[model samples]
Target: MRNFLIDSLGLAGFGAMNYGLYLKFGLADALISAGGLLLLLALAGARAAKRRNESKGAA
Candidate 1:
């Protein structure tokens, strides 16, 4: 599904970014970056879910 693909891409991007950070900086930097990214992703997903639920309720 489209959502699956998007989620897959997001995970892939996260992995790549984390690896790059680890290589350039270190494990600590990578961990921090991953945590921040996870927080952002969680917020975005929550917002999307809220919008979806509201639209369903309206209909």
Candidate 2:
């Protein structure tokens, strides 16, 4: 599930970058968006890890 979430985020990010490129957006805008997506992916991974740990502790 965690891997799936990360993969989905990556795909979305790529699509977003492509769209920005297609629209001829500025480099700074694309870089900022990429950074935002990376942050989101890291957060999602951390959340998933926390949940997994909780379940292990409960078990």
Q: Record all residue pairs in model 2 with backbone atoms less than 3 Å apart, i.e. clashing.
A: none
TM-score of 2: 0.65
Report the C-alpha lDDT of model 1 over 1-59, residue by residue, as the tens digit: 99999989988988998999999999999999899988998899899999999999999
The prediction achieving the highest lDDT against the true structure is: 1
Over 4 Å off in model 2, which ranges?
A: 1-19
Global lDDT scores for all candidate models:
0.95, 0.84
Counting clashing residue pairs in each candidate, in order, gives: 0, 0
Most TM-score-accurate candidate = 1
lDDT digits (tens) for residues 1-59 of candidate 2:
99999989979879877677647877777777778877998999899999999999999
